[model samples]
Target: MLKEFRDFIAKGNVLDMAIGVVMASAFTSIVNSMVSDIIMPFVEAALGSTDFTSIVVKVAGITFRIGNFMQAVFTFLIISIVLFFVMKAVASLKNRFTHEEEEEEEEVDPTEALLTEIRDLLREEKQSASK
Candidate 1:
Protein backbone atom coordinates (compact mmCIF):
# COMPACT_ATOMS: atom_id res chain seq x y z
CA MET A 1 0.00 0.00 0.00
CA LEU A 2 0.96 3.69 -0.21
CA LYS A 3 1.24 4.00 3.57
CA GLU A 4 3.59 1.04 3.80
CA PHE A 5 5.71 2.36 0.97
CA ARG A 6 5.86 5.78 2.57
CA ASP A 7 6.84 4.24 5.94
CA PHE A 8 9.65 2.26 4.34
CA ILE A 9 10.98 5.37 2.61
CA ALA A 10 10.74 7.35 5.85
CA LYS A 11 12.83 4.86 7.83
CA GLY A 12 16.11 6.20 9.21
CA ASN A 13 18.14 3.27 7.87
CA VAL A 14 16.71 3.76 4.37
CA LEU A 15 17.58 7.45 4.42
CA ASP A 16 21.06 6.72 5.75
CA MET A 17 21.64 4.11 3.05
CA ALA A 18 20.52 6.55 0.34
CA ILE A 19 22.93 9.19 1.61
CA GLY A 20 25.72 6.61 1.94
CA VAL A 21 25.21 5.52 -1.69
CA VAL A 22 25.45 9.12 -2.90
CA MET A 23 28.56 9.81 -0.81
CA ALA A 24 30.19 6.55 -1.91
CA SER A 25 29.65 7.40 -5.60
CA ALA A 26 31.17 10.87 -5.07
CA PHE A 27 34.10 9.39 -3.14
CA THR A 28 34.65 6.76 -5.87
CA SER A 29 35.00 9.47 -8.53
CA ILE A 30 37.52 11.40 -6.41
CA VAL A 31 39.59 8.24 -5.82
CA ASN A 32 39.40 7.32 -9.52
CA SER A 33 40.66 10.78 -10.50
CA MET A 34 43.48 10.63 -7.97
CA VAL A 35 44.63 7.23 -9.29
CA SER A 36 44.36 8.05 -13.00
CA ASP A 37 45.57 11.65 -12.88
CA ILE A 38 48.00 11.93 -9.98
CA ILE A 39 49.29 8.46 -9.10
CA MET A 40 49.39 6.92 -12.60
CA PRO A 41 51.66 9.67 -13.92
CA PHE A 42 54.28 8.93 -11.27
CA VAL A 43 53.99 5.18 -11.84
CA GLU A 44 54.26 5.69 -15.61
CA ALA A 45 57.33 7.84 -15.17
CA ALA A 46 59.01 5.21 -13.05
CA LEU A 47 58.17 2.55 -15.65
CA GLY A 48 59.45 4.87 -18.43
CA SER A 49 56.11 4.69 -20.24
CA THR A 50 54.01 7.78 -20.86
CA ASP A 51 50.85 5.79 -21.61
CA PHE A 52 50.84 2.69 -19.46
CA THR A 53 47.41 1.69 -20.68
CA SER A 54 48.76 1.36 -24.20
CA ILE A 55 51.15 -1.45 -23.22
CA VAL A 56 49.88 -4.74 -24.58
CA VAL A 57 50.80 -8.32 -25.37
CA LYS A 58 49.94 -10.20 -28.55
CA VAL A 59 49.93 -13.99 -28.73
CA ALA A 60 48.30 -16.15 -31.40
CA GLY A 61 46.43 -13.10 -32.82
CA ILE A 62 44.90 -12.24 -29.42
CA THR A 63 45.88 -8.91 -27.93
CA PHE A 64 45.87 -8.48 -24.14
CA ARG A 65 46.26 -5.10 -22.40
CA ILE A 66 48.24 -6.19 -19.34
CA GLY A 67 49.09 -2.54 -18.59
CA ASN A 68 45.42 -1.66 -18.25
CA PHE A 69 44.83 -4.60 -15.93
CA MET A 70 47.81 -3.62 -13.77
CA GLN A 71 46.58 -0.04 -13.59
CA ALA A 72 43.11 -1.21 -12.59
CA VAL A 73 44.58 -3.45 -9.87
CA PHE A 74 46.72 -0.61 -8.53
CA THR A 75 43.74 1.72 -8.45
CA PHE A 76 41.70 -0.92 -6.63
CA LEU A 77 44.45 -1.35 -4.03
CA ILE A 78 44.64 2.38 -3.37
CA ILE A 79 40.88 2.69 -3.01
CA SER A 80 40.74 -0.36 -0.72
CA ILE A 81 43.52 0.92 1.55
CA VAL A 82 42.00 4.39 1.77
CA LEU A 83 38.55 3.03 2.55
CA PHE A 84 40.00 0.66 5.17
CA PHE A 85 41.68 3.51 7.05
CA VAL A 86 38.63 5.75 6.74
CA MET A 87 36.29 3.07 8.09
CA LYS A 88 38.68 2.25 10.95
CA ALA A 89 38.81 5.93 11.99
CA VAL A 90 35.05 6.30 11.74
CA ALA A 91 34.49 3.17 13.84
CA SER A 92 36.92 4.41 16.51
CA LEU A 93 35.18 7.76 16.73
CA LYS A 94 31.78 6.12 16.83
CA ASN A 95 32.88 3.80 19.65
CA ARG A 96 34.32 6.74 21.60
CA PHE A 97 31.08 8.72 21.38
CA THR A 98 28.46 5.98 21.62
CA HIS A 99 29.42 3.92 24.67
CA GLU A 100 31.49 3.97 27.82
CA GLU A 101 34.10 1.21 28.01
CA GLU A 102 33.26 -1.52 30.49
CA GLU A 103 35.80 -2.04 33.20
CA GLU A 104 36.90 -5.65 33.51
CA GLU A 105 35.79 -7.13 36.82
CA GLU A 106 38.28 -9.41 38.55
CA GLU A 107 36.80 -12.73 39.51
CA VAL A 108 37.04 -13.62 43.19
CA ASP A 109 37.53 -17.27 44.06
CA PRO A 110 34.90 -18.57 46.52
CA THR A 111 37.62 -20.23 48.58
CA GLU A 112 39.53 -16.99 48.89
CA ALA A 113 36.39 -15.09 49.93
CA LEU A 114 35.58 -17.71 52.53
CA LEU A 115 39.14 -17.57 53.90
CA THR A 116 38.94 -13.77 54.11
CA GLU A 117 35.67 -13.94 56.07
CA ILE A 118 37.17 -16.50 58.46
CA ARG A 119 40.25 -14.33 59.01
CA ASP A 120 38.04 -11.33 59.87
CA LEU A 121 36.02 -13.44 62.31
CA LEU A 122 39.21 -14.67 63.99
CA ARG A 123 40.50 -11.10 64.27
CA GLU A 124 37.18 -10.03 65.92
CA GLU A 125 37.25 -12.97 68.36
CA LYS A 126 40.85 -12.15 69.38
CA GLN A 127 39.90 -8.51 70.00
CA SER A 128 36.87 -9.53 72.10
CA ALA A 129 39.01 -11.97 74.21
CA SER A 130 41.69 -9.28 74.68
CA LYS A 131 38.97 -6.81 75.88
Candidate 2:
Protein backbone atom coordinates (compact mmCIF):
# COMPACT_ATOMS: atom_id res chain seq x y z
CA MET A 1 0.00 0.00 0.00
CA LEU A 2 2.84 2.40 0.81
CA LYS A 3 4.62 1.55 -2.43
CA GLU A 4 1.43 2.03 -4.40
CA PHE A 5 0.92 5.41 -2.78
CA ARG A 6 4.50 6.37 -3.54
CA ASP A 7 4.09 5.33 -7.17
CA PHE A 8 0.91 7.37 -7.50
CA ILE A 9 2.59 10.45 -6.04
CA ALA A 10 5.59 9.97 -8.32
CA LYS A 11 3.51 10.00 -11.49
CA GLY A 12 4.17 12.81 -14.02
CA ASN A 13 0.46 13.77 -14.11
CA VAL A 14 0.44 14.43 -10.38
CA LEU A 15 3.57 16.58 -10.58
CA ASP A 16 2.21 18.45 -13.58
CA MET A 17 -1.07 19.13 -11.75
CA ALA A 18 0.81 20.49 -8.76
CA ILE A 19 2.86 22.78 -10.98
CA GLY A 20 -0.27 23.92 -12.83
CA VAL A 21 -2.04 24.74 -9.57
CA VAL A 22 0.90 26.87 -8.44
CA MET A 23 1.17 28.67 -11.77
CA ALA A 24 -2.59 29.28 -11.94
CA SER A 25 -2.54 30.84 -8.47
CA ALA A 26 0.25 33.18 -9.59
CA PHE A 27 -1.57 33.98 -12.84
CA THR A 28 -4.73 34.79 -10.89
CA SER A 29 -2.81 37.42 -8.89
CA ILE A 30 -1.53 38.99 -12.13
CA VAL A 31 -5.01 39.02 -13.66
CA ASN A 32 -6.55 40.45 -10.51
CA SER A 33 -3.94 43.22 -10.45
CA MET A 34 -4.51 43.95 -14.12
CA VAL A 35 -8.27 44.23 -13.61
CA SER A 36 -8.33 46.16 -10.32
CA ASP A 37 -5.26 48.36 -10.79
CA ILE A 38 -5.15 49.02 -14.53
CA ILE A 39 -8.51 48.35 -16.17
CA MET A 40 -10.71 49.64 -13.38
CA PRO A 41 -8.88 52.99 -13.24
CA PHE A 42 -9.32 53.53 -16.97
CA VAL A 43 -12.96 52.47 -16.68
CA GLU A 44 -13.50 54.79 -13.73
CA ALA A 45 -11.93 57.69 -15.61
CA ALA A 46 -14.22 57.08 -18.57
CA LEU A 47 -17.33 56.75 -16.34
CA GLY A 48 -16.57 59.97 -14.40
CA SER A 49 -14.97 58.40 -11.30
CA THR A 50 -17.70 55.81 -10.71
CA ASP A 51 -16.51 53.10 -8.37
CA PHE A 52 -18.31 49.90 -9.26
CA THR A 53 -16.85 48.15 -6.21
CA SER A 54 -18.73 50.48 -3.89
CA ILE A 55 -22.13 50.40 -5.58
CA VAL A 56 -24.64 48.62 -3.32
CA VAL A 57 -28.33 48.44 -2.46
CA LYS A 58 -30.34 47.56 0.64
CA VAL A 59 -33.81 45.98 0.56
CA ALA A 60 -35.84 44.81 3.53
CA GLY A 61 -32.99 43.68 5.78
CA ILE A 62 -30.53 42.30 3.24
CA THR A 63 -27.67 44.40 1.84
CA PHE A 64 -26.71 43.68 -1.76
CA ARG A 65 -23.30 44.79 -3.03
CA ILE A 66 -24.18 44.89 -6.72
CA GLY A 67 -21.05 46.79 -7.61
CA ASN A 68 -18.82 44.06 -6.21
CA PHE A 69 -20.86 41.54 -8.15
CA MET A 70 -20.28 43.53 -11.32
CA GLN A 71 -16.58 43.67 -10.61
CA ALA A 72 -16.57 39.92 -10.11
CA VAL A 73 -18.46 39.44 -13.36
CA PHE A 74 -15.95 41.58 -15.21
CA THR A 75 -13.09 39.67 -13.65
CA PHE A 76 -14.63 36.38 -14.71
CA LEU A 77 -15.14 37.65 -18.25
CA ILE A 78 -11.52 38.75 -18.57
CA ILE A 79 -10.22 35.47 -17.19
CA SER A 80 -12.51 33.47 -19.45
CA ILE A 81 -11.47 35.38 -22.55
CA VAL A 82 -7.78 35.01 -21.74
CA LEU A 83 -8.18 31.30 -21.04
CA PHE A 84 -10.21 30.79 -24.22
CA PHE A 85 -7.49 32.30 -26.40
CA VAL A 86 -4.74 30.44 -24.58
CA MET A 87 -6.58 27.15 -24.99
CA LYS A 88 -7.23 27.91 -28.66
CA ALA A 89 -3.53 28.54 -29.27
CA VAL A 90 -2.55 25.41 -27.37
CA ALA A 91 -5.09 23.35 -29.35
CA SER A 92 -3.73 24.67 -32.61
CA LEU A 93 -0.18 23.82 -31.53
CA LYS A 94 -1.27 20.32 -30.44
CA ASN A 95 -3.04 19.78 -33.75
CA ARG A 96 0.07 20.90 -35.59
CA PHE A 97 2.26 18.47 -33.64
CA THR A 98 -0.10 15.48 -33.79
CA HIS A 99 -1.35 15.94 -37.36
CA GLU A 100 -0.17 13.21 -39.69
CA GLU A 101 -0.39 13.60 -43.43
CA GLU A 102 -2.01 10.58 -45.04
CA GLU A 103 0.48 8.39 -46.89
CA GLU A 104 -0.47 6.35 -49.94
CA GLU A 105 -0.88 2.69 -49.14
CA GLU A 106 2.15 0.60 -49.99
CA GLU A 107 1.84 -1.88 -52.85
CA VAL A 108 1.16 -5.41 -51.67
CA ASP A 109 4.06 -7.88 -51.93
CA PRO A 110 3.97 -9.66 -55.28
CA THR A 111 4.26 -13.15 -53.67
CA GLU A 112 1.35 -12.44 -51.28
CA ALA A 113 -0.83 -11.08 -54.12
CA LEU A 114 -0.05 -14.11 -56.30
CA LEU A 115 -0.96 -16.49 -53.45
CA THR A 116 -4.25 -14.67 -52.84
CA GLU A 117 -5.14 -14.82 -56.54
CA ILE A 118 -4.27 -18.51 -56.67
CA ARG A 119 -6.46 -19.17 -53.56
CA ASP A 120 -9.41 -17.34 -55.12
CA LEU A 121 -8.97 -19.21 -58.43
CA LEU A 122 -8.91 -22.58 -56.56
CA ARG A 123 -12.07 -21.67 -54.63
CA GLU A 124 -13.84 -20.68 -57.88
CA GLU A 125 -12.76 -23.98 -59.49
CA LYS A 126 -14.00 -25.94 -56.47
CA GLN A 127 -17.35 -24.14 -56.55
CA SER A 128 -17.73 -24.81 -60.30
CA ALA A 129 -16.88 -28.53 -59.85
CA SER A 130 -19.39 -28.77 -57.00
CA LYS A 131 -22.08 -27.15 -59.16
Candidate 3:
Protein backbone atom coordinates (compact mmCIF):
# COMPACT_ATOMS: atom_id res chain seq x y z
CA MET A 1 0.00 0.00 0.00
CA LEU A 2 2.81 2.40 0.81
CA LYS A 3 4.58 1.55 -2.47
CA GLU A 4 1.38 1.98 -4.40
CA PHE A 5 0.84 5.38 -2.81
CA ARG A 6 4.39 6.42 -3.62
CA ASP A 7 3.97 5.31 -7.22
CA PHE A 8 0.74 7.26 -7.50
CA ILE A 9 2.35 10.39 -6.18
CA ALA A 10 5.36 9.94 -8.48
CA LYS A 11 3.21 9.68 -11.61
CA GLY A 12 3.55 12.48 -14.20
CA ASN A 13 -0.20 13.12 -14.32
CA VAL A 14 -0.39 13.72 -10.56
CA LEU A 15 2.59 16.09 -10.66
CA ASP A 16 1.23 17.95 -13.67
CA MET A 17 -2.18 18.35 -11.97
CA ALA A 18 -0.56 19.68 -8.80
CA ILE A 19 1.52 22.17 -10.82
CA GLY A 20 -1.59 23.21 -12.79
CA VAL A 21 -3.53 23.82 -9.58
CA VAL A 22 -0.80 26.03 -8.16
CA MET A 23 -0.36 27.96 -11.43
CA ALA A 24 -4.14 28.38 -11.76
CA SER A 25 -4.36 29.79 -8.25
CA ALA A 26 -1.68 32.36 -9.07
CA PHE A 27 -3.25 33.12 -12.45
CA THR A 28 -6.65 33.64 -10.79
CA SER A 29 -5.22 36.34 -8.54
CA ILE A 30 -3.71 38.14 -11.56
CA VAL A 31 -6.97 37.93 -13.50
CA ASN A 32 -8.93 39.08 -10.47
CA SER A 33 -6.63 42.07 -10.07
CA MET A 34 -6.90 42.99 -13.75
CA VAL A 35 -10.67 42.77 -13.60
CA SER A 36 -11.05 44.74 -10.39
CA ASP A 37 -8.32 47.35 -10.76
CA ILE A 38 -8.03 47.91 -14.52
CA ILE A 39 -11.27 46.87 -16.21
CA MET A 40 -13.78 47.67 -13.45
CA PRO A 41 -12.85 51.36 -13.38
CA PHE A 42 -13.62 51.72 -17.09
CA VAL A 43 -16.83 49.74 -16.72
CA GLU A 44 -17.91 51.81 -13.73
CA ALA A 45 -17.13 55.03 -15.59
CA ALA A 46 -19.17 53.88 -18.58
CA LEU A 47 -22.06 52.92 -16.34
CA GLY A 48 -21.77 56.25 -14.44
CA SER A 49 -21.42 54.39 -11.17
CA THR A 50 -18.62 54.98 -8.66
CA ASP A 51 -18.74 51.45 -7.35
CA PHE A 52 -20.28 48.61 -9.31
CA THR A 53 -20.70 46.42 -6.30
CA SER A 54 -22.69 49.15 -4.52
CA ILE A 55 -25.33 49.25 -7.24
CA VAL A 56 -28.28 47.25 -5.98
CA VAL A 57 -32.06 47.08 -6.18
CA LYS A 58 -34.67 46.99 -3.50
CA VAL A 59 -37.91 45.06 -3.88
CA ALA A 60 -40.92 44.45 -1.65
CA GLY A 61 -39.35 43.57 1.71
CA ILE A 62 -36.34 42.11 -0.11
CA THR A 63 -32.98 43.33 -1.39
CA PHE A 64 -31.29 42.27 -4.63
CA ARG A 65 -27.59 42.70 -5.43
CA ILE A 66 -27.71 42.65 -9.23
CA GLY A 67 -24.60 44.79 -9.47
CA ASN A 68 -22.55 42.22 -7.61
CA PHE A 69 -23.81 39.48 -9.92
CA MET A 70 -23.01 41.58 -12.93
CA GLN A 71 -19.57 42.30 -11.57
CA ALA A 72 -18.95 38.58 -11.13
CA VAL A 73 -20.13 37.88 -14.67
CA PHE A 74 -17.87 40.61 -16.05
CA THR A 75 -14.90 39.22 -14.15
CA PHE A 76 -15.70 35.76 -15.49
CA LEU A 77 -15.75 37.07 -19.05
CA ILE A 78 -12.40 38.87 -18.70
CA ILE A 79 -10.81 35.81 -17.14
CA SER A 80 -12.21 33.62 -19.91
CA ILE A 81 -10.85 35.88 -22.64
CA VAL A 82 -7.44 36.09 -20.96
CA LEU A 83 -7.33 32.34 -20.47
CA PHE A 84 -8.33 31.74 -24.09
CA PHE A 85 -5.43 33.84 -25.36
CA VAL A 86 -2.98 32.28 -22.89
CA MET A 87 -4.02 28.74 -23.86
CA LYS A 88 -3.73 29.61 -27.54
CA ALA A 89 -0.22 30.97 -27.07
CA VAL A 90 0.81 27.91 -25.09
CA ALA A 91 -0.62 25.58 -27.76
CA SER A 92 1.22 27.44 -30.51
CA LEU A 93 4.49 27.26 -28.62
CA LYS A 94 3.95 23.56 -27.94
CA ASN A 95 3.23 22.94 -31.60
CA ARG A 96 6.31 24.91 -32.66
CA PHE A 97 8.59 22.91 -30.35
CA THR A 98 7.07 19.59 -31.45
CA HIS A 99 7.42 20.59 -35.09
CA GLU A 100 11.10 21.43 -34.63
CA GLU A 101 11.67 18.09 -32.89
CA GLU A 102 9.94 16.26 -35.76
CA GLU A 103 12.03 18.12 -38.32
CA GLU A 104 15.22 17.21 -36.46
CA GLU A 105 14.14 13.56 -36.33
CA GLU A 106 13.40 13.53 -40.05
CA GLU A 107 16.87 14.79 -41.00
CA VAL A 108 19.08 11.76 -41.73
CA ASP A 109 22.82 11.75 -42.42
CA PRO A 110 23.41 11.34 -46.15
CA THR A 111 26.55 9.22 -45.63
CA GLU A 112 24.77 6.95 -43.16
CA ALA A 113 21.81 6.56 -45.56
CA LEU A 114 24.14 5.66 -48.43
CA LEU A 115 25.93 3.11 -46.23
CA THR A 116 22.63 1.58 -45.24
CA GLU A 117 21.56 1.11 -48.88
CA ILE A 118 24.93 -0.37 -49.75
CA ARG A 119 24.65 -2.82 -46.84
CA ASP A 120 21.18 -3.89 -48.00
CA LEU A 121 22.37 -4.43 -51.57
CA LEU A 122 25.37 -6.42 -50.37
CA ARG A 123 23.10 -8.63 -48.30
CA GLU A 124 20.84 -9.30 -51.31
CA GLU A 125 23.85 -10.15 -53.48
CA LYS A 126 25.20 -12.54 -50.84
CA GLN A 127 21.78 -14.26 -50.66
CA SER A 128 21.71 -14.66 -54.45
CA ALA A 129 25.24 -16.03 -54.49
CA SER A 130 24.32 -18.57 -51.84
CA LYS A 131 21.32 -19.61 -53.86
Candidate 4:
Protein backbone atom coordinates (compact mmCIF):
# COMPACT_ATOMS: atom_id res chain seq x y z
CA MET A 1 0.00 0.00 0.00
CA LEU A 2 2.83 2.39 0.86
CA LYS A 3 4.65 1.56 -2.34
CA GLU A 4 1.48 2.12 -4.35
CA PHE A 5 1.00 5.51 -2.69
CA ARG A 6 4.59 6.44 -3.45
CA ASP A 7 4.18 5.43 -7.10
CA PHE A 8 1.02 7.51 -7.41
CA ILE A 9 2.75 10.56 -5.96
CA ALA A 10 5.79 10.06 -8.19
CA LYS A 11 3.71 9.93 -11.39
CA GLY A 12 4.20 12.89 -13.76
CA ASN A 13 0.43 13.30 -14.12
CA VAL A 14 0.02 13.89 -10.39
CA LEU A 15 2.96 16.30 -10.28
CA ASP A 16 1.68 18.15 -13.31
CA MET A 17 -1.74 18.50 -11.69
CA ALA A 18 -0.17 19.91 -8.52
CA ILE A 19 1.80 22.46 -10.53
CA GLY A 20 -1.27 23.37 -12.55
CA VAL A 21 -3.31 23.96 -9.42
CA VAL A 22 -0.65 26.29 -8.03
CA MET A 23 -0.40 28.21 -11.29
CA ALA A 24 -4.22 28.46 -11.57
CA SER A 25 -4.50 29.91 -8.06
CA ALA A 26 -1.88 32.54 -8.91
CA PHE A 27 -3.63 33.34 -12.18
CA THR A 28 -6.99 33.68 -10.39
CA SER A 29 -5.53 36.29 -8.02
CA ILE A 30 -4.24 38.35 -10.95
CA VAL A 31 -7.56 38.11 -12.79
CA ASN A 32 -9.47 39.03 -9.63
CA SER A 33 -7.29 42.09 -9.20
CA MET A 34 -7.79 43.18 -12.80
CA VAL A 35 -11.57 42.90 -12.44
CA SER A 36 -12.01 44.46 -8.95
CA ASP A 37 -9.12 46.92 -8.71
CA ILE A 38 -8.90 48.06 -12.30
CA ILE A 39 -11.98 47.26 -14.41
CA MET A 40 -14.64 47.72 -11.72
CA PRO A 41 -13.23 51.07 -10.65
CA PHE A 42 -13.23 52.26 -14.24
CA VAL A 43 -16.79 50.94 -14.72
CA GLU A 44 -18.00 52.57 -11.49
CA ALA A 45 -16.41 55.87 -12.42
CA ALA A 46 -18.29 55.85 -15.70
CA LEU A 47 -21.62 54.79 -14.14
CA GLY A 48 -21.35 57.30 -11.25
CA SER A 49 -22.88 55.21 -8.43
CA THR A 50 -23.09 51.72 -9.79
CA ASP A 51 -21.98 49.97 -6.61
CA PHE A 52 -24.61 47.23 -6.74
CA THR A 53 -23.47 45.59 -3.50
CA SER A 54 -24.63 48.61 -1.53
CA ILE A 55 -28.04 48.81 -3.17
CA VAL A 56 -30.81 46.83 -1.50
CA VAL A 57 -34.60 46.59 -1.94
CA LYS A 58 -37.24 45.28 0.41
CA VAL A 59 -40.45 43.74 -0.94
CA ALA A 60 -43.05 41.93 1.27
CA GLY A 61 -40.46 41.76 4.11
CA ILE A 62 -37.93 40.06 1.88
CA THR A 63 -34.82 42.06 1.06
CA PHE A 64 -32.65 41.47 -2.00
CA ARG A 65 -29.51 43.24 -3.05
CA ILE A 66 -29.77 42.99 -6.84
CA GLY A 67 -26.73 45.22 -7.21
CA ASN A 68 -24.56 42.61 -5.53
CA PHE A 69 -25.86 40.04 -7.95
CA MET A 70 -24.96 42.32 -10.85
CA GLN A 71 -21.50 42.87 -9.45
CA ALA A 72 -21.00 39.13 -9.05
CA VAL A 73 -22.12 38.51 -12.60
CA PHE A 74 -19.78 41.19 -13.95
CA THR A 75 -16.88 39.81 -11.95
CA PHE A 76 -17.65 36.33 -13.25
CA LEU A 77 -17.63 37.65 -16.80
CA ILE A 78 -14.27 39.33 -16.37
CA ILE A 79 -12.74 36.26 -14.80
CA SER A 80 -14.07 34.04 -17.58
CA ILE A 81 -12.70 36.31 -20.30
CA VAL A 82 -9.31 36.63 -18.63
CA LEU A 83 -9.07 32.89 -18.08
CA PHE A 84 -10.08 32.27 -21.71
CA PHE A 85 -7.17 34.34 -22.99
CA VAL A 86 -4.74 32.90 -20.47
CA MET A 87 -5.69 29.36 -21.46
CA LYS A 88 -5.48 30.28 -25.13
CA ALA A 89 -1.95 31.56 -24.68
CA VAL A 90 -0.94 28.50 -22.70
CA ALA A 91 -2.45 26.19 -25.35
CA SER A 92 -0.59 28.02 -28.11
CA LEU A 93 2.69 27.58 -26.24
CA LYS A 94 1.96 23.89 -25.69
CA ASN A 95 1.06 23.47 -29.35
CA ARG A 96 4.32 25.14 -30.39
CA PHE A 97 6.45 22.69 -28.42
CA THR A 98 4.38 19.71 -29.51
CA HIS A 99 4.51 20.82 -33.15
CA GLU A 100 8.29 21.13 -32.96
CA GLU A 101 8.58 17.59 -31.63
CA GLU A 102 6.21 16.32 -34.31
CA GLU A 103 8.29 17.99 -37.02
CA GLU A 104 11.43 16.43 -35.60
CA GLU A 105 9.81 13.03 -35.75
CA GLU A 106 8.30 13.53 -39.23
CA GLU A 107 8.44 10.28 -41.20
CA VAL A 108 10.81 10.11 -44.13
CA ASP A 109 9.99 7.73 -47.01
CA PRO A 110 12.14 4.61 -46.87
CA THR A 111 13.03 4.91 -50.55
CA GLU A 112 14.19 8.49 -50.10
CA ALA A 113 16.26 7.53 -47.08
CA LEU A 114 17.85 4.65 -48.94
CA LEU A 115 18.54 6.84 -51.99
CA THR A 116 20.16 9.49 -49.81
CA GLU A 117 22.39 6.84 -48.15
CA ILE A 118 23.38 5.55 -51.58
CA ARG A 119 24.14 9.05 -52.81
CA ASP A 120 26.43 9.67 -49.84
CA LEU A 121 28.22 6.36 -50.42
CA LEU A 122 28.65 7.17 -54.11
CA ARG A 123 30.07 10.58 -53.25
CA GLU A 124 32.55 8.97 -50.83
CA GLU A 125 33.66 6.48 -53.51
CA LYS A 126 34.05 9.20 -56.11
CA GLN A 127 36.23 11.23 -53.72
CA SER A 128 38.43 8.19 -52.89
CA ALA A 129 38.80 7.31 -56.60
CA SER A 130 39.83 10.90 -57.40
CA LYS A 131 42.42 10.75 -54.64
lDDT of 3 by residue, 47-73 (tens): 776445886899996889988997777
Pairs clashing in candidate 1?
Answer: none
lDDT of each: 0.81, 0.81, 0.86, 0.86
Model 4 is weakest, by summed lDDT over 10 consecutive residues, at 43-52
Best by TM-score: 3
For every candidate structure, what is the RMSD over all alpha carbons to the true structure, in angstroms? 8.1, 6.5, 3.5, 6.7
**What is candidate 1's lDDT per residue for 1-131, written digit by digit as tens?**
99999999999999999999999899888877876787667777886764548779999999999989976776677678767877899999988765544322355679999999999999999999999
lDDT of 4 by residue, 1-131 (tens): 99999999999999999999999899778888887787777777888854669878999999998879987887788778877888899999999999999998897889999999999999999999999
lDDT tens readout by residue for model 2, 4-120: 999999999999999999998998887778667866677678877645689889999999999999877876886677667768999998876666432224557799999999999
Model 3 worst lDDT run, 10 consecutive residues: 47-56
At residue 61, what lDDT does model 3 achieve? 68
Show the colliding residue pairs in model 2: none
TM-scores for all predictions: 0.55, 0.54, 0.72, 0.63
User: What is the TM-score ranking, best to worst?
Assistant: 3, 4, 1, 2
lDDT of model number 2: 0.81
Cα TM-score of candidate 1 = 0.55
Runs of candidate 4 with Cα error greater than 4 angstroms are: 89-131
The global Cα lDDT (0 to 1) of model 4 is 0.86
